[model samples]
Target: MDQLLAQLPPSVVALLDKWDSNVLLITIASFLAWLVWKVIYNRLEILTQKTRFHWDDLILASVSAPISALIWCWPATISLGFILEDYTQSKLDWLSTLKLMLVIGIFVWITMRLVTNIEDYALTQKNRDETTVQAVAKVARLFFIVIGALTIMQSFGLSLSGLLTFGGVGGLIVGLAAKDLLSNFFGGLMIYFDRPFKVGDWVRSPDREIEGTVERIGWRMTIIRTFDKRPLYVPNSVFSSIVVENPSRMLNRRIYETIGVRYDDSQQVSLIVEDIRSMLESHPDIDAKQTLIVNFNGFGPSSLNIMVYTFTKTVNWVRYHKVKQDVLLKIMQIIDNREAQIAFPTQTIKLDLENAGEFAGMQPQTEHQQ
Candidate 1:
């Protein structure tokens, strides 16, 4: 390589000397980085497909670029060292500082990748909730970021004592300015511990009139995907303030109905009520252990009212509806077999000939008829 450069023209040789070491090192580093990245990344991708454990693949994917850069940093620093000795003192100092910063950047990048992958791993655990996992991961990331910043500052020979003192005062101002943000942050923490609802659980807030499946629990907001598929970003603080109903926790679904029989068929009310009660008790879908009430509740103006109160074994909305429908159909069949009728609101008024004279006397007489 040296002989090849020697054979070149004098001007070309001078130009070559200007860029020789740095250029050669960088080219070699880039080639090696590419080769390593391709080989390792492809192998990991194959392994990821073959195995159930995916965290390795995720970590590799996330850190690949940073690892390549870190590899290049070695050659870069060596190249920069050659320039430092030959260049102006100021330029040498700047390059040295830049190289240090580059090293710190790579460290921070790798740390972030590791933290993210760990968080993702936590999410895969059957016992862990998505909201809690996310919160922990975010806190870990923030911690690393703060540490990285402080490390970079310390590398630059900056005093943290003064910064810490200033931060104490500044933090107070920042806390006051971002009170709502702080409140939400703490609210999210409370949710993590309290666990009122989790991701994928259906929840509704009676006060806010919001009902949806929890999509994600973020640091400041909890994302809910409504039944209509609209994304609702609710502040974590709002959850702490309101009553949230998590229907997903229900063991059974309720079915309460009022069926009125016609006054004329009131004689069969006792038999009808007993049959209905027996049907509910023997039904496959109705929960036998739960409350099952069937009785002649009251008499309305036009009918005798029977109240049927029961619970379905299944808590699933669709299945509960199907069970309720089946029960209602069976009830209708029972009523029809007994020669009974379901009643609707109706009214009756009787007029007598003895009362006709008063209405006739109240009518105004026409002039031509008179």
Candidate 2:
């Protein structure tokens, strides 16, 4: 083997000289690393299928690319020393800094992957909504990226004290410049922790005349999709400023209506009122636990008003509407069966000839008198 190497071309001999046993060692190490990764991945895949905790599989999948990159890059980086032996120490130091930076980058990548996996797992557990989980994950990723950047800077022999001082001053300036933005960000954090309303929750801000389903909660704003299907982007600060009504949180929806009966049906009004109350009490959808009131409120200009105040067992809009319609229809049927009539706005005017002396004087004489 030595004689054959010597018989090679001069350039080839020099190249072989630079490429020493370390190259072979690096290749073997890289292969072993790859093999280990493959074995672990396959085992995790099988385990995930059998285990209840499937998040482990997700985590493995997320880190697979980064692990592969690290495995290959580590070996190549080790071989760089043998290849660049004739290079200056300063150039080699740069390479070392680059390698450190790559290591920090890989750490950040892994951290981000873990954050994503954790977010996904939390979502499946229903502990938080999609928007909230994503926001939290992004915040975590930002934290890891900042730490990774600081680590890379430190690896390059950069002082963090000066950088921290600069950052402090710069942060203050940015805070002052973007006061509203900062307020919104903190407001979003408040919403996240307080959980006033989540995605898909029906919310209405009476002060702002905003009523919609929460689609997403971002760093600075919350997106609402209105009933008309228009997208509304409201700042998080606005939510803090306004009164937000989350109707989705209500256990039951309310139904308050006034039914009018004609004055002629006054005798049957009491019976009608009692029957209506009975109907509400017996209705399956009506929430019996809530205050249910049926009373003869007062006499209106056109009719006698009967007040029906009750709550349904459902908070769903469509279901509530259906219940309300059915109740109203049943009330109408009861009134019809009792031979009663609903009142309408009407007016009556009368003319008395005896009281119209001025009009009588202006009228023409009868034919016989003429």
Best by lDDT: 2
Minimum summed lDDT over a 10-residue window in model 2 is located at 85-94
| Segments of candidate 1 deviating more than 4 angstroms | 1-22, 33-55, 84-91, 94-96, 118-128, 350-370
Best by TM-score: 2
**TM-score of candidate 2 relative to the true fold:** 0.85
lDDT of 1: 0.86
TM-score of each: 0.80, 0.85
